[model samples]
Target: LLLDIVRLKGSHSAEHIRNTTEQILDHLSINDKVYKIITDNGSSMIKAYKFGLSVSDQNFEDEEANDEDSMDVDEQIGY
Candidate 1:
């Protein structure tokens, strides 16, 4: 069910995506009813749902965190 189609004007960072999703769920009063969220393999989407309540995989989270850290370092050094 497509509740709403929002047009975001600014950055599409992980935090922004998470906040936008939370806001939408809250507005619809269905935050607690959401079991899973399906999104593309984009980094922002992955980060936004990485630690979701329904999903529990410490190893996966650690791996993703390490990957993100390395990417940050690489970006800083102009990789």
Candidate 2:
């Protein structure tokens, strides 16, 4: 996923966030599957909730468990 942020002096941050979120949701809802998502470290985006989808924290866990089933089972053990 690509996040395009336009610098507009007068626009509200919430408006931009809302528009972007809606656009992303619309596109993703129609597509086959949403594998992963990327967003900047902004206040609005940081609070994004994971609804049982695969989310990458950009840190490699291990080499052996790359698949979802292994990752899910291993994540609990790690915690």
Candidate 3:
């Protein structure tokens, strides 16, 4: 569903896209309810959702560690 359409007046970099998406989710109070986001194969889109939404206060290091752990688990399970 299309909830809102915001008009931005600046460069649409990865940071800008991510910030705008976060703002919209926060404004709707659905940050915790989001599971996945679909976007085109643009570079900015890929970078914006590289770590998913910042639903909590997790730092980049923590996310990297978690990703490593998941990879290990997947490797062990022959995934």
Over 1-79, each residue of candidate 1 has an lDDT whose tens digit, in order, gives: 7767798769999888888888898899887666567889999999988987343466557768999999999999999
- Native-to-model Cα distance after best TM-score fit, residue 69 in candidate 3, in Å: 24
The Cα local distance difference test for each model comes to 0.81, 0.52, 0.83
lDDT of 2 by residue, 1-79 (tens): 3544455456546555555555665665732244455667776555543342343443334323477667798898994
For model 3, the run of ten residues with the poorest summed lDDT: 54-63
What's the true lDDT of residue 1 in model 1?
76
* Tens digits of per-residue lDDT for model 3, 8-52: 769989999989988998899997766568889999999989988
Ranking by lDDT: 3, 1, 2
Clashes of each: 0, 0, 0
Worst 10-residue lDDT window for candidate 2 reads 55-64
State the local distance difference test value for candidate 3. 0.83
